[model samples]
Target chain A: MSVLLEARGVCRSFGGLDVTRDVNFKLVSGDRVALIGPNGAGKTTLVNLITGDIAPSRGQFWMGDDDITGLSIPERVRRGLVRTFQTTRLFANLTVADNVALAIMQRKRISRRIFSSATELPEVKAEWSEILAHLGLDHLAYRKVIELAYGQQRLIELAIGLALHPKVLLLDEPAAGVPHDEAPKILDAINRLPADIAVLMIEHDMDLVFKFARRVLVLAAGRLIFEGSPADVTADHEVRRAYLGSYADARHSA
Target chain B: MSDITMIHAPQKRVPFAQEAAGALTILALGAVGYFLYPDDLAFLTRLIGIAFLVLSLDLVTGYCGVATLGHAAQFGVGAYAAGIACIRGVTDPVALLGVGLVAGTIMGLISGALITRFRGLPQLVLSIAVGQLVAGLANKLSWLTGGSDGLSGIEPGKVFGVFGFDMYSRTGYLFSLAVLVITFVVLQRFVRSPFGLMCRGIKDDDLRAKMIGVSIYPRLVAMYGVAGAVAGIGGALTAISTGVVGLDSVSFERSAEVLVMLVLGGAGHLWGALAGTVIFMIFEHVVAAANPFHWMTMVGLLLILIVVFAPRGLIAPVMSLWTKMTRKGKAA
Candidate 1:
């Protein structure tokens, strides 16, 4: 598969401490990749570097063939490189639909229209409904995001990310704080995403990473230590020792 | 795919009916003021002009969530632009207003560039700093700006060369009211548009807004420019009608006072600005005259009362009450 998003020799450090160093990876089209590591393994930092939340210390990355090392976060998003927060950041005061509608509007480039009501636009309404329905959140579309459960908010975070029409989506722990029962909602939503877009998820739940990502990359001390299939990741002794800690499921899967 | 039917809420429709009614009320108030208290019309006109400043302040501070108190920088620039134009052989009201608009827009862009780059306390402090800087410059430029003594003798010609700017300020009041209404309507339209929605999103969460692909800085800059132009119109009106532009017009005190009005009215809702300014000004007018010595105390007490009773601003409680009443009417 051809690479859609590539991070080449990406490095980030603060106060002489490296958060990510010489981290290189490629997200090919339709790639379902898992980025897993122990605490402070720089998973989120890598995502931020790609999404332009923070500039890389010394490296260049690419969106397809276009070098986007200097683009702003919004500019990167406009170029189809999108990300979600670990804690699922959202416009808590806005309605679920407004949250989704805004991304769709930005994607459609109609967000700059100074006289057109986005909610009143039939196309916006339809797209909002469609995205909501995809996440099974159509019923709660009008409810303020703060009113929803944390799990549902995560789904909304995903919905907003999906609304960007991303060519590469870097999900930073999409199910981090969600309860076990509610976590399935997120998994269900993720499972339903169209496969044409590349999705790289950083998840602690090994089961979810295994279930969702066909390929897994394990990071340790800001380096890409292991990259293989989910089954291969579980069996890799270095990955288990450095990050996974214990994979009782590894044996069962094998 | 499961069937998903959207539930249309009562407030889903455009607020045309309500806005129209509000516009009518404003027109009615102006008409009544024109007839009933013709002598007091000048004061009212001045309040309406300041209301434009408050309204524009509401846009950047209220809607876009760019914390600013130096908005008077733009207002002062607008006033000086109009005053200077008038002094330099452009006594035409429309033309002077145009100069004010351009000046205000430029000031907004400049100040907005600096202000939008910072957040929280720094933003507020920068706003105050910028406002003070402009006031200082205006005071220093005595020859051009007519400093310390203030810009004077700014005489605007008759309305379309017909109704003269009389001693009673009847033309000024009507003209200010007309400008206020038109600008308010346009602002209403701007806030209701998709770009307006983007501003709201940016206001609620600019970080997430950026992640979702809204160009936060440029949009904010544009909003500031538009808002500055609106405020410029107000500043120009003050210059043209009052025939003076003073350093006091763009002082830190004016900026703080306008911020208070916006907060008093309800920041997010556009009409709340007008409501806050009108209420504040009316209370000031009536109480200051009646009490004279303790008027500041009275205004302070009013501010305290508003904070205690309506933390969201005076407009919020009234709006909620109105919605409750209408919902009850529907159920009944």
Candidate 2:
């Protein structure tokens, strides 16, 4: 599989402290990569850098060979590089369908239409309904997002990401605050995404990371400590010492 | 299967019915105003003009979530543009409105650019500054704008070159009402469109809207321009009806009053703006006439009651009631 996204020497600093120190990684098509890091490891900051939410103090991002270091957030999105928020940032007052429809409309370049009703647009309706259905969220389509349960709201965020037609999707802790029972639903939704897209998920729950990602990149103290398959991740010395000592030992004994 | 089909369900006819109802209400209002306040046509006409200004404010402050207190800048510019055009021999009423529309649009774009750059308190301050600056400029250019005394001698020709603006203010009132209705209809379509939905999204959360690949700054600027156009028409209506343009049109007080009217009626709802304008003006007229000394106290009480009882503005409760009644009817 070809690389869909690449981060070369990505570094960011808050004040004089380096948050992301010389981070490097590649997300190839069909890749399921989980970025595992302890709190304040600059995981979200790295996602922000890639998504153009915050500029990197130093480094470059490549989208399928095109250097997208200076592109605007919307420009990066247009090029099929998208990111979700750590905390679900949705149009809360709008309906679930509207939240999804806005993304689809932007993708279709029809968000600027003044004469046509958004809900009545045949193309937009078809795509949003299909997205919601794929994510098993059709029932919540007309309901305002503010009224939805937290788990369902997470699903809507995924639905929006799907609507953007991203080739490289950066999910910033997609299951952060979800109730235990509803987390599997989110995983199911993630599993159902198109096979051609590359997904980079930032998750703290090791079980979730192992279940969802084939490859794991461990970030510790602003540096990548380990990069390997889940099976090998637990075997790495630095990764164990830095992040997963007890969990890694427990997994090996089990 | 039943669930998926809902997406493909025939386009909801509810909004259309609602639109029809709103249009009829406006027409009915015009008729009632015409007959009930025959002598107060000039005042009624003035209310219609302010109605446009409030609606324009809603587009920016309500829909786009751009807090502005200087919308009167656009209105004043439009009024001055139309008044000056008329004085300079662009005697046609429609042509004068066109001039006002252009002037308002330009002002909207200018203000939108400056305001959209900041958020929260700074945005409000910037808006107030823009309004004050425009008002100051209008005052300073007394030679051109007629300054403190106001610009006079604006003689608007007949509507369609046949129906002259009568001394009894019959034609002026009718013309303003007709234009108001047309503007309302067009705006209804505008606010329901995809663009309008996007603006609503921006209002709800700009960062989410931006992350969804929407270039929010431009959308806001565009909305401001549209708001400007609406306010411009309102200003032009005032200029043509009253045959005078004053600094009060662009003053800080005018902007604050329009904002108050919007909050009173419901910001974000077009009909709310109209209702607010009508209710506030008429209430002011009657109360001030009855107790000119303590009229402010009554208006303050009314505002407090509305805020305490109907925080979403006067229109929201009525809307909910209508929805509840309609839903009950369908269930039965």
Candidate 3:
């Protein structure tokens, strides 16, 4: 498969201590990958490096054939690489429809005209509705984001990322902080995404990783200890010792 | 009609009614001013022009979240540009406004470069410094700027080649009102557009805006420049109506006063700026005339009361309430 994103020799350090030390990964089109780790394993730091929120001390990241190491957050997003945060972030004052519409506007690269009713434009509204439907969030489309429940907000966050028409998506704990019954909604919403867009999910929920991702990469103390399928990871003794411990059975229960 | 048709119909008509209401409100205010106090017409007109400045301030501060307190810099620059143009033989008021627009654009571009580099308190301090710098230069340039006394003998010619600005205050008042209306329409249209929506989103959350592929700095700079034109037009009107450009036009005090008026009316909505200006000016006039010694105290008390009761500005809550009532009515 052709790679859509690559992080080669990536390293991030804060002051004297290293958070990510020479981590490398390649995400190809249509690939389903889960990046799993114990807490404080540099998952968020790595995501920040690839998204250009914080520049890497030493590394090169790529989007398709282009080297995107020097690009800003918006510049990277323009290249069809998008992500969602662990804590859902949205335009709190605006309605859900406006939030998705703004994302659509970004993806289309339309001239943000200063004398037209863009929030209700026919094509933009259509795309917004579709995104809301994909996440089962159409009922709350016209409501302000601040009024929504945490689970609903999480779904809206994913809808916003999808609105960008991303080539490769990095979801930082998509189901984190959501209610028990609402986890399936998040999973189902993620499962409905198009096949051509590769997804890299950073999730603590072992059941979700094993159920959703075809391949898994394990990180412990800023090092990649294992990379394989769910079955291989379950059987690997090092994976059990370093990270999973006794939680491996949770994958089979699903 | 079906339920769907009824629902869609109201949604479609809301914008049309809203647009008409703004224009009609301007006309109503002008008509009321014409008959109510022909003597205070110039003061009333000046208030409207200054309202334009407050509205412009709202664009960045209220919507785009660029905190600033030196907006009067743009206003003063526009006034000086207009005054200089009239001295240089361009006596037409229309041409003078064009000069102010250019001057304001230049001021915005230069200041925006410095101001947009930082945010929150740092941005506010930079803006304040820029204001002081401009005022100091205007005061120091004695020969060109007339120093602290300001530029005098600015003679704006007949507006539209027919309306002569006589001593009676008819032409100047109408001209100011007309400028206010036109700028308000343009701004109202702009803030409701797709670009405006994005700016609001940025105001709500800048980090999220960046992640959504918004090139924020350039958009903010552009908004600042556009806002400059509005503030500049306001300054030009003051120059024309008063027949002199004073250092007070760009004073930090004037900036603070306009900010107060904006916050009083509500900073985010265009209508709130206008409402705040009218209320603030009228109350000040009444209190100063009745009890000159305690007028400032009364005004301070009035502001405290407003802040305590209607913190969102006096206008936004009303607008929101109106929306709520309409929605409830429809549901019933």
Candidate 4:
């Protein structure tokens, strides 16, 4: 698999304090990578840099051969680099199907068609309906997103990401607020994602991380400390000191 | 195929039904006005003209979530363009509207470029400034625009080379009513379009919209241009029907008043814009005539009540009622 996205020594700072320091990584197609870090490890900030939400003070990002450090958020998205929010960020007032349909229309570049209803467009309707149905969200298709439960809304977020047809999908804590029972559904949805897409998920749940990610990258105090298999992450001294403290120790004894 | 997608696709039906309902309401309203205010066709025509302005405002502030207080800038520019075109011998009504539409689009693009760069209160302030700036220029270019005295001496030819624009304003009223209905129908299609849905998405949350891979800035600027085009038509209609373009046409008060009307009727939905215009203008006319000295007080009271009760505007309650009734009927 070829590298689909690469971050080369990326750095960012707010005032005098560094938020992300010299972050570097490569995401190849079909890679399942999880980025784990403590509260201010700049995990989200790093994702922001990659997504062009904020400009990196140093280093560059590339999609294959194209340097994308200066591309706008939407430009990156159009190029198939897409992300989901840690907290669910959806078009709350619009219907679930419309929320997904908007992304599909954008991908198809027909969002500018002003003479026809978006939902009635055969191509757009087909895509959103298939996505919603695939995610088992067909029942919530016509309902306003706000009317759905929090866990359901997160699933909608995933449904939208899939609709964007992303080659590199960045999911920021897809299971953050989900109830325990509802989390497996999120994981199942994530697992069902197209096999060829590279997914970089930031999750605090180690159990989830082990199950979902084949490889994991750990961050501590704005610096990457480890990058390896899920089993290797627990035994890394630096990652253990920085994040997995008690859990790592328990696993070590076991 | 899931039975739900094939069998229960009310989403496909809602826009057409709502659009049909809106068109019929506009026609019914025009008929009522034609019979009840036959002598006041001029006033009715004026109301229809302002309806265009409110609808255009809805496209921007209501749909795009761009807070603008200077929409009159587009309206005024369109009016002046049509008026000047008429004076320069572009006497055809349709041609004059075309002139207004182009002029409004350009003005909308210019203002939208400046306004869409910011968000929240700053956007509102920028819109007001743009409105003031346009009004100020109109005031300064007295030689070209006729300044405070207003641009006059406009004489539009027959609408289609047959129907004369009569002194009683019969042709003008009918022409405006037809245009309003057509514009409403087109706008109904517009707001339900993917472009319209995208704008609604931006309004709800810009970041989410961006992450979806849709560039919203140009979309918003384009939307403003569309809004300007609509407002311009309204402005042109006013110039053609009234046979004049005044400083008030582009004034800050005109912008504020239309915003008030939009809020009163509702902002996001096209119907609210029309409803707001009809209710506010008629209410203003009746109250001002009844208690000219304290008419502002009564208008204020009505606005307060609407805000307290139907915060979404007067149309919200009616729409909910209609939807509820339809669902109940379906259940039955």
User: Highest lDDT among the candidates is held by which one?
Assistant: 4
Each model's lDDT comes to: 0.86, 0.89, 0.86, 0.90
Per-residue error at B152 for model 2, in Å? 1.0
Q: Could you estimate the TM-score for every candidate? A: 0.93, 0.95, 0.95, 0.95
Provide the lDDT at A95 for model 1: 77
Across all candidates, what is each one's fraction of true contacts kept? 0.74, 0.70, 0.75, 0.82
Tens-place lDDT digits, model 1, residues B1-332: 00011111323455565457667878998898888887798899899989999999988988899998798989989999999999889988988889999999999999999999889999889988999999999999999998899999988887778877977898999999988877877777788678887888888888999898877888989999999999999999999999999988999989989989888988887878999999999899999999999998999999999988887788787776665666577789
Determine the iRMS, in angstroms, of model 3: 4.6
> In angstroms, how far off is B35's CA in candidate 2?
1.1
DockQ of candidate 4 is 0.58
How far off is each candidate at the interface, as Cα RMSD in Å?
4.5, 4.0, 4.6, 3.8
True contacts kept of 2: 0.70
Candidate 4 per-residue C-alpha lDDT over A182-230 given as tens digits, one digit per residue, 9 for 90 to 100: 9999999999999999999999999999999999999888899899999
Superior candidate under DockQ, 3 versus 4:
4
Candidate with the larger DockQ of 1 and 2: 2
Off by over 4 Å in 1: A244-254, B1-19, B325-332
In model 1, what lDDT does residue A70 have? 93
| Model 1 Cα shift for residue B177 (angstroms) | 1.0
Each model's Cα RMSD: 4.6, 4.0, 4.3, 3.9
Candidate 3, which segments miss by more than 4 Å at Cα? A244-254, B1-11, B14-16, B328-332
lDDT of 3 by residue, A1-254 (tens): 89999989988889988888988889999989999887777888888988999999998998878999999999999998899999988998788888898999878876378886766778888899888987788888777788889999999999999999999899999999999999999999889888999999999999999889999998876777889997798788887776654354445564
Ranking by TM-score: 2, 4, 3, 1
The true-versus-predicted C-alpha distance at residue B10 of model 1, in Å, is 6.7
- Give the alpha carbon lDDT tens digit for every residue of B1-332 in model 3: 01111111223645656567677889898989988899987788778778878987898798888888899999899999999888889999999999988888889878788898899889999999999999998899878778888999998899989898877688888898888878887887788778888898899988999999898899888888988888888888888877899899889998888899989998778888899999999998889999999998998998999999988889866776666667788799
